[model samples]
Target: MSLAFLADYANSDDDSSEHKDIIGGNNISRSEDSNGGQGYCSDKEDVGHGKGWWRGLVCLVIGQNSQLQELASACMDRLCTGTGGAQAAVKPRYVRVLGDLHISLTRPFYLQRHQLSEFARELESSVGGMGPIAVGFGGLSTYTNEQQTRGFVAVDVDHGKESIRRVLDRVNLVVKKFGKRRFYRSPRFHASLLAVKLAGDREMSEIWGSGLANEQERIAQLVAVRIDTVECMLGASKYSVALDRTD
Candidate 1:
């Protein structure tokens, strides 16, 4: 999503200002562990996208090395030879997570097993490590789809007790403006690196009650999305993305 869209998505355009640390205060105390223990931000503080507010915005992908950045873009361009052609190739958004973790952020949304194997090989042979790759199972009940993509909620919440409804509310709110087509018959929530698209019946059943695709329940799940970083750029490129964490 565009920064304009993101600012809106974060509901942070208000002129008011509020600052309260929830976990990591401006001190940004570091630890031997790279996860950087959660910092404090007053839930009441207006630290979203508002001007002058230190909402922990991350833009490392911008103004970095240009040559290595085109990695993903180059791949997409090559894949264009098959179907819609290269011009239609999907542009990848750059992002970096705090701490050294999985480095598989550039994989296509869905992937077949064989492709996943190839991706594993590529990662092992890659130049710089991206971080530990993130892997997950639930597709929703706690997520908002962004630009045909659904990512893990940045909201930080205890998963063992929180119901999935928490995440769904936020996700539904974010995607409400999208056309009906974006709503899948079975909207299973998953932030994919690579996978093949599934056939429709499109039933996405995670927790709660069954029959998701066609059933619209007032049910919702609150998800905690504690964002560590958010990188952005325009045009196409895979290598354009790089992951960096504060020391």
Candidate 2:
């Protein structure tokens, strides 16, 4: 989880003239729009039908901020250009940048319409009193989904790990009561910065080694994040629970 290699790669020029900007016009602002439609209710008719189940996820959302947005833009640019085969391997449509960042407190699950109110109420009661947490980025890292269909580049949480874990513990309790799966037993808390669908079994590291190992300290200093609210997404609906702000 280091970013030292980026320094060298950032300066190298691509020899291929045909190399298109994988990022292209889809820069910072556009990237945010890419995720806008997801996890949101589109049809008015889908609002409240207690007969059906809704797909759900609980997480600590990283709201839009200038600093993190800049870092994410930089990470996306360098990773796509610097990595040898990344530009060609990357599916631009799948890329996710700053605005979509969040740390999952529970795995995606299902909630029946009748259970939504109780679930949200219990979750709020459990974590509402917790104080806001200041979290820092450790460095860059990579992960593949359970099905190994897609790959992700993310920033690991360097500080405030325990506080996040405490919140996760509470979230899991609520999830368990609803008969949903809890999060990982050993979680590596991170905010996914970029996502891609590679052509084959090509590992992201094959595109480039994790990140700039030598530049970790500098990167950590460049990014500072805060978590004060936890959001639960059910279908297109959202429920936000604010943390205690009192010092």
Candidate 3:
């Protein structure tokens, strides 16, 4: 489906903040807070056609765990060191650090300020009965944007695929009510580890062949995470729904 609604708003003069696309999803990015948080605030907070609308981005927060962080660091180091000449081709800025990892539940969309409460309420009610999900990383994979301008290195979801898909279905119902695009069809469900610009198949192959792809089995055994919260971030504010149900 066309995400022109989000694309137009993202490119509009009113909101010019940088976006970091989610892995296996569309051009969804999170705004950084001045206090070093992931909270995003718009430049024209009061200028949604004079209707108080904000670009709403939704996803599940995979908080920084020591194990995951170390895994990311080690993998990056290997990529930079093993790939001899190819390492020089990658810029440091495009690399995703500890705080940038997440699993997106829906593509970005527009939501008015007035609907914030109801949106949060509906989202909470939808998956409140679900307990925490224990997810493990499968293998290292590569993805590029639609324009093929950027490439990403990500770890696909191994265990807990069905549980995550259930959450995606529930979130999409709420997203449709607000007239936003649902999650990608046949989503791969992963946490982006690194992003590079202009890296085509040859370049990606060089990086993968450098030894990162071979480490997948070991990586899967090394990293397993417990996800307990799904967060809804609207412009500068954030709301979280905990997965604490016992039954």
Taking the tens digit of each residue's C-alpha lDDT, what string does model 3 give over 124-226?
7777657788888877666655454545566677888998988889999999987887877788777765554544444555554545556655685756788
lDDT of 1 by residue, 83-154 (tens): 222222222332211121111112112222233223222222231223222222222122222332322112
Best by TM-score: 2
List runs of model 1 lying over 4 Å from the truth: 1-196, 206-227, 237-247
Please give the TM-score that candidate 3 achieves against the real structure. Answer: 0.72
lDDT accuracy of residue 209 in candidate 2: 61
Which lDDT values do the candidates have, in the order given? 0.21, 0.58, 0.58
Better of 1 and 3 by TM-score: 3
Candidate structures ordered by TM-score, highest first: 2, 3, 1
RMSD (Å) per prediction: 19.3, 11.9, 8.4
TM-score of 1: 0.18
Worst 10 residues of 1 by lDDT: 232-241
In terms of lDDT, model 1 sits at: 0.21
Identify the runs in model 3 with alpha carbons over 4 angstroms from their true place: 1-52, 82-88, 98-100, 199-210
